[model samples]
Target chain A: MQKRYCAIWFRYLLTDWLAIRKPELKDVPFVLAASEKNRIIIKAANQLAEKQGIIPGSTAADAKAVIPDLKVFDFIPGKAEKLLAAIGEWCIRYTPLIAVDAPDGLLLDISGCTHLWGGEKGYLQEILKRLKGKGYYVRGAIADTIGAAWAIARFGKEKAIIEPGGQTEALLKLPPAALRLDTAAVDRLHKLGFYTVQQFIGIKRSALRRRFGEQLLLRIDEALGTAAEHLQWIHPLHPYQERLPCLEPIQTATGIEIAIRNLLETLCNRLKSEGKGLRVAILRCYRVDGKLVGADIATGRPSCSVDHLFKLFALKIASIEPALGIELFTLEAPKVEDLMIDQEILWTPEGCGLESPQLAELLDKLANKIGAKNIQRYLPVESYWPERAYKPSLSLSETTTGKWRAGRPRPSLLLKKPERIEVTSLLPDNPPMLFIYKGEKHIIRKAEDAERIEPEWWLTQSPHRDYYLVEDEQGRRYWVFRSGHYDDADSQWYIHGFFA
Target chain B: MQASKASIIQQLQQKILSWQGFASPAAAETKRMGLGPLEDAFPNGVFPTGAIHEMLCPTREQGAATAGLLSGIVTALMKNGGVCLWISADRRLYPPALLSFNILPEQVIFIDVAREKDVLWAMEEALKCEGLAAVVAEVREVSFAQSRRLQLAVEDSKVTGFLLRTDLKKLTTTTCVARWQITHLPGALPDGLPGVGFPRWQVELLRVRNGNPGSWIFEWNNKGFVPVEEPLAETEQHLTRQVG
Candidate 1:
């Protein structure tokens, strides 16, 4: 079958929206104006204002003269594009592919989709009637090419639907301006007495290029179906999405679970065959009450196992509320990675370390139950600060070249931050003889020599810390640090960590 | 005739222990964790793998001591290149300190869950994984039922589990193979030195199923656990109380 395109034009896109919002603005002769170059120029004129010779692009002062009762409203930037995008999304129900034509039109690829609405004529009528009922004036035209459909939608006076393979004849009667050219090019064509496309349809290729430049020839070829035109859809097609449209609304958890199982089975089959695994998956339920509820699950590693993926999603099944029953269920894997075929070994050998598939699956379950950030793996780094000595590894397979510093006696449990302690020392720089922590006094029986650790100069200018391993009389060991030099009068003491 | 009768009685006792889930040393991986005489307090004269051991830590100091001691044992279990999972709520176990115990810090995965309930959940899940060497979880409390569930998971996977119970207020009986409490002891330097010596702890086996309960002083040097004789002359007699 031949490819066909349909273009829908909204003549008064913004004004129609304003009239629908404020019904009083329906019959008023209004024009939307915007300030440009210190002058308020009219950007769009309603039908009533248009009939009164208040054309757009004229100064607001001149438009006021044409109609003394004319109401001028500010032209909001990007309002037309927003309106077109909303309408295009709604048009997805008609055709799966819809692209915004910008300013005032939409292009839909209606090749295989027209048969769903009985034909191109019925399809065009259904869209135009629905949009018109929403208080907007819309015209739609269908042809073999996007350029031809676009031109006919905005300029064709007699027909709205051009027959298939008739774009050439349909484009012949339209004026040169309908080819969507720059204003300068249109003016040049008008000045050359080429009022309609038929006037230059038989021109020599080299002569046309030299006369009107390359754009005119390109536009003509696109209009006549000799060249292909590509369009960017509003919603990019999801390649890993599976949809289940239920004949009856699903109200029970069992039904929803069945839907999810079916979707995952199909999705996992595809992933396994393609040697790819899903890293993130989302399940969206479209309820009958016009509300969408979604649940998403992510994996620590790329996985395609049906049972494992199902378990992760099962933990999140309670969060999805199927209020009034769900009519549609869509499962989409938005992020995926290539899965090595050899990683699918069913029986993992003993002591596989981090490379074990069972370990990754266990972590994925825990992450989904709580969160991903709560689970972490650390690798040693060459730093003196206790906190900076290790960095969290992003993946299980990540390795580090730096070895952990084992020369010094680091505490088994390091506090998140050091706690202030009241101390009484015999001398200024000597270790505290007795310390009061949390209202309990501990007399120090033995104290190690102070190991002064200087702050990394490049990172911060904090004072050096003199750390001492002090064991209380009760045999509880604590790591305490004295800030700054003893001469700094403001030097304080704090308990930093615990030793086993 | 008397020797034959004694051998039959010993064989019957071994069968009864095996029926109670205490496998013979040859039947399971009999890798010594270098705990010296401490292993004698467990059934069959071996440290129980595929079983849960609960450690009571009433204070932060005890928690640190427990972590240090567990890391020493974990190093032996991970000799086959297996990884270990350390699940806790608000974990403060510094990874760099594990290096002193001869443990590759990267080989131990740390999970910091905000909820105490999830810590147990993660531990049970980690215990079920056969590839892991062991799972060490720190929770404020664990109900007997929760500990039983974790014990069941480890039994099938043959993975060791250590439960560091920080809050012993609700301490109750559980299905753990043994319960331990390790408290910090004042380090003793050689020849009256003026610095902190190697990590020394008074390891007490508070409860052990089907075995004797005892306490001893153990010190972690550069290599492994070494049983230390208490320096007090009067308590030196109790140092030999552990049965082999």
Candidate 2:
């Protein structure tokens, strides 16, 4: 296959990323700024900020002077590189061979992959349209070589592609800067009256190398397919695993516990050395009686703690019968990620909750003993929609997405589905004085004011719920709500949750 | 020769008393398990912590009463913020409701196993965890020998085990510290006013290997359980009908 290359340039990557998370900042003038020793310098500006004469490489003061009400944000370090690497990963959907072109670009080898998308033109259009829909300003070009594709994408004035073997002719029309030569060298050539690649094409290679260093000739060679360029493909993380063979076929529960502990130690050591942690593992015991037993352990956070892992495994050791005897044990970490630093111990041991690690160990034990789906921890999502107000997090160490906007108190236990109950109320909007739930009648001894939770008008068509915190005669607090208005005598009232 | 024989006899008697847990170590380790007046029947005014106790509820309707009684026991045992595990084939425990007894939801872990085999396997394993305050297991039937296995595990770990026998008909016999039955009773409204009242339970001690057995009426209000002098005497059918 030919080494066909495609380069994508994200011109306003930082600005676009900011706007994607915050849609209200689309037309507003904002700049992503980086502080260097107390000096705030603008790195990238949104489309509107650019139109207002704010550009990169200017100080925040200069940008604000241009537009007084400009909003500036602290640029997140390594965010651009991470985004480019992520795009390099996503580009695997286009072609298997791809690499990061750095700062704000991705390179993909699309030789045999173009036909799958109906030729290079449709492919380029599709890629551009998809990225544009994601709020990114992009320019893409495909050529026979990566150097040629990169030069043409950023500097070429013609079509996005050069005809086969016609790159040299196309290269002649573009300026010397298109070859990726240093800025100093390009300016020197401009002063020497050699402004375009066509002027240098007539000179001998040796003469050009002696007059202006070898870098100039190498750049030109690389751009015209005379020199080779390397591309690095993104690879996924491999699963971590370990296996152990027992010399003796043991049948006791104690023997199985020892085998599981040994397997955990070997697997966890490997994970720890790589600065990684495991979230899920499979421990399999093969009995000599021709039967196999396996137990799956999942942790609340990415952890490689051998002791904690061993305890979770010990809970299931009783299930392995070892009918005749067991001979082999294998442990594989199927889910792993970079280790995260949970908060340090700040509170007393007998505090409201356990320390993060202690809590993680406890959750892992519970999840292993019980079913995984029965446990959940929710973090607030940045939304006003009721259903989207919070999202179940995968790990306990995940940083909060946004501040949990406080309103009225929420119940600790919410029913899977709200159950409709029969309520007796004195006034139209008053709290229910008596209600029957699950066939038991509850009389409200005390009630708080009705807390109205209106639906997000732009997102849904559901009726508003007016919730009340009512204490039953047994002194158990319940969260009950009346759906919609009370003009009808039989309006639906539901028991939503129980307050601890 | 008579003095030598008498000394050997005294040594054997002391060893037997220690084995029967009538000596110093046993007396020091036994704790008052918050069984109100029931503690007076034991050798010391305490309930044994390193022993196995059984609570049998005959039908599904009585499961809630047993759970409520167990929640109070767990709260008392886990005074130092220790954890408790509940293992069963079908989990119907509403954990948030236990908060009424000052037992936080996070302090308890619930395990539901589909196989009867795994239920005992997990319970036996949990009983061996000295870190835990107590282990409550719900199984239909546990033979006397199986109870002995659970009892042996607790003896080493000093973890209290509650074997809640959901199927009460198989009351063959087991070597347990005591056996209890919790039945839901009609809660009396103060002055006969028409509203729901506190949780009232009729607790019966069916058998005790080494202590006296009797029955008591307990009223669980917000301030915890309080013994009532007179038991509520309504027919059982009337109470089941309200819940059904």
Candidate 3:
């Protein structure tokens, strides 16, 4: 029940990494070195290089002098840190609570996870076996405290899982460097003839603080579990998501639907109690073969009604392929909004169909079956240009404050972009007599007055447009615009839209 | 009880055809949506509400005319202030133009789905909702089975559905109240005025269940459609084929 931690010390991490890349180099004496102002310093050494008295942080020249045949490698920046973090992520299989100790080590909180793998012995064995099998030289130790585990892993003679309340005894034989003190303090301790932790274990706290500063006492107290130091474990992220792990993998549509309904019930209940509603819900099904298929739906208004949400999701339920079988399903409401309840009306306000909640749900279902962008309602804006005259509104209840653009006839459908048309006008300024669009010639049977729409000079340098409603021989009406003044050489004609 | 089994089936089918939608009417009488002389074209002198109608157009020009005609119809259906849902693979109906047809830009909801399957599915969903006045769908193809499904959905909720068939004319077997082909027609000049005429549509009734098929000229003046007297150049019995 006590908190337990595991420390994985990656000795000779850089050389081990190079050896993993090149198996032939493992038996050779090699050192990873960094260049500083034309001086090469050893950062890490392989086991063979370490035997020749080559010390890391020492000059590469001294390492080569100790062993002339020592292989040298450029120290890659952040490579060791990245490798340690990757190994820590892999350790999620062992314990979800794990953190990168940076550079060359990982710390794992194996308190509750150890029993899942049949106790600490089996858990430690599995971790060591897998990491070592990956071509890395690793030393691992477990203790009640992270500091104690870290010290025992890097400095202890035996790689043992120290029982709870045994951290002090376990750290006694280790060197003072195991306290993770600064180099200056370690040398000062050595000058004081306190090489082993056993020599400082019985020292007075105030006296130790006076001689070696408070850091030493803090380190010793942390290892002994008298002063707690929190390990920055990998914090797991759980959004407004509900996960359902099935007892047996479900392959049938009915089974999947049932699972989805169950998950939705719990999720919707949570949102409702929180006075919030989901604008979008994504249902992800994890297949037995490690594949994922999902279906998502969006609501115009925030909604928590189970039946309505179910119907919206039901529209696309057929699209989700169950595949071989689905083992887990996660329903997540990634976009949510506050559900502010509207004041109940004593009398129905004309029942314009927009105010009814049922209508909102119906529109949601329709949008899902089609798409969100496809369902649009517009409101008048205070602009003269056709594109700026109105704006697409998400909610039908949005009131229009601007005056509706005059009673002039606008095309039933507006083209996404105006298309160029070849035209011949009666005069230089008159409406076109004949026009060519899409290779089809349209003879204008009738023409209306040109409504001059001036461009916003502040917006662009384009000229004003003279828009005319013309009826072709086919009886189809079109809105055409001529850009720029008649005197301008670059004046162009375009068919903007159709009149229904 | 007095009718024979086969006769009963025939009568029941006739009743179903009279109803035209997915479900029977909540009210006893079938809704008559006919304006002017067009009422004579439908069964019981009424434009069938809560039913599915086909508006077929062969060309892109005619398709726009058909959209105009349907917008008028939808606006009429929602005169009591309701929403109209329009679903299409590529939506060409400009929201601003619906304003000229007396339908507010906000009253009409447009859904542009890239897939025909989703368009039909959305139509069915809209047709099942009791709040909507009508649903208009522009699609490339609608198999008899798909139309039947749409018909069934509209039947129960009594929501009207306008199947605006554009680009193709492949209506063989479908259970719609009426099949129509609308063409762009020259609007009549009011008292010989030199200006654009009111929006006119030459509507050809290809087939009508429990009613006689006929062709007529109509002019929409925003308020509603008014039957305009044609030149009377064609014979009454002569069947007119729909032009692309």
**Candidate number with greatest TM-score:** 1
Q: Please count the clashing residue pairs in each candidate, in the order shown.
A: 0, 0, 13
Better of 1 and 2 by lDDT: 1
Per-model TM against the reference: 0.72, 0.54, 0.62
True contacts kept of 1: 0.84
The candidate, 2 or 3, that scores higher on TM-score is 3
Expressed as tens digits, the lDDT of each residue in B82-112 for candidate 3 is 8888888877667777777778778777787
Q: List model 1 lDDT by residue over A215-319, tens digit each.
A: 999999899988777888899434899999999999998998899999999999999989899999999999999999989999988899999999888888888
The deviation in Å at residue A201 for candidate 3 is 34
Quality of candidate 1's docking, in CAPRI categories? medium
Error of 3 at A37 (Å): 54
Clashes of 1: 0
Model 1: how far residue B168 lies from native, Å: 3.1
Residues A1-500 of candidate 3: C-alpha lDDT, one tens digit per residue: 68999999988778888898999997899998999888998888888888878888899998888888888989888898778776777788888889889778999988888888798988888998988998888889999998999999899897579988899888989999998889999999999899799998898888999998989888888888889897677754347899999989898888978888898899989999899999999999999899989999899889888888987777777888887889999999999999969678787543247777767887787777656666788888876788778888877678877757756788877888899999999797678899999999999988888989876778777788899999987678889999988778998999998887
Q: Residue A271 of candidate 2: its Cα lDDT?
A: 88
Error of 1 at B163 (Å): 0.9
Report lDDT (CA) for all predictions.
0.88, 0.76, 0.82
**After superposition, candidate 1 runs with Cα above 4 Å error:** A1-239, A243-256, A284-294, A318-330, A340-348, A398-403, B1-9, B25-28, B229-244
